[model samples]
Target: MKPSFTFSSNSIRLSYVSWICIFIVLLITISLLPIIWRGLEDFNPSDDYRLPYELSYDYWMFSCWCKYACSNYPIVMIGDSVVWGQYVGLKETLPYYLNELEKTNQNYPLCANLGVDGIHPSAMLGLIKYYGKSISNKHVILHLNLLWMSSKKHDLSDTEEFRFNHPRLVPQFYPKIPSYKAKFPQRANIIVERYVPFSSWVSHLRLNYYENMDIGNWTMQYPYRNPFNAITFQIPYPEDKPHSEPISWIERGMTKQDFPWVSIDESFQWDSFKKVIKLLQSRKNKVFVIIGPFNPYILTDESLNRYKAMKKDMENWLKNEGISYVSPSDLPNEFYADASHPLKVGYEMIAKELVETESFKNWLDK
Candidate 1:
């Protein structure tokens, strides 16, 4: 009956506590300003774990060379990372390179890069759809991944990702080979990549590596990591192995032919492929279907059997269509970035093909 605290006193206590919380938060935020900045700058929609293919600046630089060397024509390169070269800046990537190349080569055409890594079944068509209207002599090159046609046995999803020197990943892209680190050291490097954010310490030091001496006032450098050296992985060219993936999986009974009890997915990836082509054609743009290199694991014994069945379906559909395609098997593995990806050498080979193709000739005339 004698203990009634006034409302004004309680209100004062609450206000004081609220002010203290705000002050503490302000202090913490100020103290961690650098950490916050690093997190913000390095934000990647994808896993960003780090994979070899993702971090291979050398390969990406080569793609730029191809673009710079062939910038005279209306050149458009469309595909996934095989086209994007994610780790490098856009200017340092293939498209930028093409622009530079066109300036130097009177005979070369203006080239464009419309590639997005981890974009398999949908985005390729987007490249042609967007770039088809922007310039003259619309020429587009596509890198087709046959594995996209493989069975759901991979069990990878749009969000899953496998490891590489860095995590070669995409948002809603592909599934990771769980335990990839335990299995592939080079592949699992993202597990412990020394993420030394841009600091005054790094800036004060002179770190420059050169590849060519053609930059005029500014030298052309092929910047490489100190400990993050690149390792070459063997990618199987089409001519190298007709059915590598199947063979590898066959050992695990992925093949249904020998057992004669296989149940196929009854799905043909090319059906959607036709829709993509039509989308590009409707926009009055020509589509250049670039085929990517197939790895030995992609075309094995079981895969051969599957291809035999699928070939007829593809050819029948192509009877009344005009498409442009090229295979790395037509070239050599030295051009590939890894077992399944292409690098600088590969981009050069691709550039050479475009400059020499009949499709390119047609574009030149248009």
Candidate 2:
């Protein structure tokens, strides 16, 4: 009753051509993926400046900006790698523990961490100026390590580029220094890189791949939940101490031209340190300082005396200014992953001590 519907030879040929065209198009698209997804690593600032794909200050700044843009976090932690939780996971960081403490205490202060590796007081001063307003009228727990004041590696120049480029709700105030040459992006590059799937995928490969190769743990490829932060679940053992035998405490395994025990007051860092305090006070942000844990194994009799003297000087200064502070005096050697950074147990102890403090409680209550 009806004509049979079937493809003629010419129509069949046309269908085959169409299918081939679609396959070719997909092949071209797949070939362009890497170029289209060229990420942060593609733009190396200089020969000396290496881009960290994971748990970088840039990522932290970006995350904070996203979280705080619409909502505010009452508690913000600021410091260097120690506070950033290097060699640890996002869940093991001090801020994460503090959040746990908040839940345990039945409080509702949302905590945000802005710690980046190698951040000193001068950069911190600049950071506060830029992002302090976001956390204004909230409790600011600032990690004050003497190493920032004492370490030759910690300088304003080290932070110049990172501060200039990292995302912030407020405008960045870059110092007009001769050394600073990188131009600031009109929009937040960090946010752009984060949302783009290709860039983040590349970052995960870089962060996790090299890390596994370094530790001979290639088998444990997907060890972290938050790969953006490069947070790893690898449990470090005592045999895994970075050095074969303990190196000099002051030297910390690296041999630099300048000794570490140099006077903090004489360094230009003191000026930035003072500025950080002044800026926080001016912003009406409650500033609470916590001196991070140092590996006791690094201390010899001589280095111990120098460390104590520095601590005493810092304590006197805080006391005179009536700045509430706590310096943990008894961190054990076993709790350390390196000369300065602590293991999970150490982070837990630090968070526990800070959250239980009357001063921190009073500041939050106020």
Candidate 3:
């Protein structure tokens, strides 16, 4: 025999209402978290500031930075690690040099560095589309690195699973990345984060405070430690130093080799890059493109010929679009850090070339 428990209709209705109230409270709290987090930190970024290297994957923080830059700066330099100055210090980047040049004329239009490491055109498309709403009605200096089209795998045309940077920034499902093996749930979560501030805020906490781990995993790893103790309430600053010693690729033992360059028509990266330009233009951005001064010195003759043909086609397209651009002549071999990235002096030279170019000067004047 078992004891029976019963509830009146009114009592059952009250229980349901209690759960509903609890759910509403939870929803409101989650939505308010991102706002609360923003208030907790005073994020007045300096003129020379780029996104901290560690926070590169934190799109929420990127959004915050982008908004601030858009509001403050008239010119924003957007691209991958090349523009970010991989082998140069914070003050040695292209944007910094551009700003220094601008000082001779006027200081009103300061250039902001919005580059992220390993951000290929595909991820870049997603990044600007979702996180860069504040960039409209501004002057954009967009960099196009040809190294991404130098191979099938680099262009993301290979249909095999492999690791790539900023998976969270790329399209998850529709244009499938055969190499991206994230399961459905993970893909869905990524989509949610793009639209939901709360989800991204949680990710910021995980990245900055919890050793890049989720609360559950962090707890398991630190068994007896209090989870709250993990948060230091301080955002880590990016070191102003270069990631690599400022050395030319030749000095690093890199040799000239034949690259299996992909054609512009078949290039996935090229297509994505065109779309990025269109997206920026649609937002009323005055777009100026800087095609890479790729290290022609490091290319075998055949590879160099193929690269030249590809570059010519790109120039023709830009001309048809009436877009202002500059494909700077390659710097001396000693100026190259690798096939695409420039050394510190290389950045300075590139900036000087840009300011001296008739087209670049015209765009700036406008």
Candidate 4:
């Protein structure tokens, strides 16, 4: 004989056993909430890991740019932080400046900035693999910084443990590096991060969100958060700072003996750079490699020589390959935003120079 269950207002009153079951179910749902939220989003664990040049925040910000640019088919610009235009407003960025130039001059195709900070030649390949298909057949202006090739051999490892700061999550494609408690005190932060829905936490925090609450297309801006405090505040430019005064960069110290830069002629980064160029060519994209100007004022004599050599070698390579490029002459330090990145004046100078170039004009007309 089997026992039959019956329900009545009084008879089915909440019992200890029934209440315990309800609590257990609720607890399980709460624990699994973040996991469930993560599964629904566009987040990828393997690509989220940080390298020296790459940061977790950079990937997220770049993803936003990719999503926006993929649908527009604008002329895409690819490169490192200089190209990324860090510490500047979106309006002040290179792509924005180029587009503004296009609007004024009636250029054929508008430029889209797809630059990300800490992007080496190898990482650029990764970005192309992830987002290149979206901009296929479009003209791409690649900012080739010689410093990318000068990375040390040991710095080239994409799989090293300390390269990433985030605690290892269930990887999508690659194996994860373990997170030690000593190193990553907040190893489980991913759970909370993933559990929270984008609408709840991420979207509201964007630079555009602060600019306007409309949640328009251009939501990502220069993340002006305090590195130490994680506080997002407006950047205060000193009133006395002359428009001609260039912002100093900590990396300007790299020109000293402490920072050794070897020739990148035989580097893993060089191979990766070649691979990216080939990949772009295969896709029938017209590639224009632009060599941006460096801050000559801060460079030591040795560093200056290194820069010149790199530039000459690059020119040789481009000449051999029959690639069209715009190599800007050295500019005053006042034109720079930092050690590497350009200010508004500098970016405008680059665009103007490219516009003046017959090769660039020929490429655009085609």
Better model by TM-score: candidate 1 vs candidate 4: 4
TM-score, each model?
A: 0.43, 0.57, 0.93, 0.59
Name the regions of candidate 3 deviating beyond 4 angstroms: 1-14
Ranking by lDDT: 3, 4, 2, 1
Best by TM-score: 3
lDDT of 4 by residue, 204-286 (tens): 23432243233343333434543324323322221222223345454343333222455555555566677788889888888
lDDT of 3 by residue, 1-366 (tens): 665966456543558888999999999999998888876866777778888888889888888889889999989989999998899998999999999988877756479999988899999999999988888999999999999999888888778876888888888997877677899999999999989889889888998888899999999999999998877767777689998888999899999979888898998889999999999999999999999969999999999999999999999999999999999877988999889999999899999999999999899878
C-alpha local distance difference test of each model: 0.41, 0.56, 0.89, 0.56
Model 3 accuracy (lDDT, Cα): 0.89
Error of 1 at 235 (Å): 34
TM-score of 3: 0.93
Please say which candidate is ahead in TM-score: 3 or 4: 3
> In angstroms, how far off is 238's CA in candidate 2?
26
lDDT, candidate 2, equals: 0.56
Preferred candidate (lDDT higher): 3 or 4: 3
Q: RMSD in angstroms, candidate 2?
A: 12.8
- Residues 277-363 of candidate 1 have per-residue lDDT tens digits of 676566565666655554444345766566546544554454447565544443352333333454444455555555567754564
lDDT, candidate 1, residue 112?
Answer: 52
